[model samples]
Target: MKNTLSRLKYLYRKASRAGADYYNAPYRAAIARARREEDDLFMLLVFSEMMGIPNPAGWYCMELQPLMLERFHDWHTRMGMERSPLDNFRCC
Candidate 1:
């Protein structure tokens, strides 16, 4: 009887996790998409000069390029871009 009770407890925990995951799937996806969009906008701002859109803060943005380099590949992939928009800059 003790073994059976332990088994039941484990099953209950598993089921609760599964149910929570199912219910939260849409919210998780929306949040992920929103984060990706936010990252993309930040990338655009950092690389605006590459797009021929003269950025007023272009000089300040240059310093952040090295720090943002690692995320560039993943960001472009998430945006469905074939290559980095700043390919000409080659900082990534």
Candidate 2:
């Protein structure tokens, strides 16, 4: 009887996890997409000057470049670009 109860508890835990995952899948996906969009916007703000668009806050945004350096490569790749147009900070 003890063995049967333990097995039932294990099965219940497994089912609970599966149900939670199913319910949270859409929220997880939406969060991921929102993060991606936010990242893209941040990159644009930081590199607008390179793209020939004069950003009023370009000077201020420059300070964030170093912090965002690690994501530069992934950002460009996600944009489906072969290379970053900014020559000074190549992420390819």
Candidate 3:
């Protein structure tokens, strides 16, 4: 009886997971696109000064440099940049 209960519980969990995935599948792509756009905007906000765009929050954004530098390469590539846009920071 215990063994059967365990098996039933496992199947119930699996089915619930499958149902959740199916329900979320349609919104996944849209969520991903929105997240990408959001990241792009964030990168722009953080690196606007280096990109020749004057940013009002430049001072505040500077604090994010250390945290964001690691993602610089991916961000620039996605933005169609062949190389880093900042003269001071080269992220190939």
- What are the per-residue Cα lDDT tens digits for candidate 1 across 1-92? 99999999999999999999999987997998888788889988998887889999999999998888898888777768767666576624
Better of 1 and 2 by lDDT: 2
* Worst 10-residue lDDT window, candidate 3: 83-92
- Model 1 TM-score (2 dp): 0.59
In candidate 1, residue 77 scores what lDDT?
72
Segments of candidate 2 deviating more than 4 angstroms: 1-25
TM-score of each: 0.59, 0.68, 0.74
Error of 3 at 76 (Å): 0.9
Model 1 misplaced stretches (Cα beyond 4 Å): 1-26, 79-81
lDDT of each: 0.84, 0.88, 0.91
- What is the overall TM-score of model 2 with all chains considered together? 0.68
lDDT of 2 by residue, 71-90 (tens): 88888888888787687777
lDDT of model 1, residue 48: 85
lDDT (Cα, 0-100) at 57 in candidate 2: 94
Inter-residue clash pairs, candidate 2: none
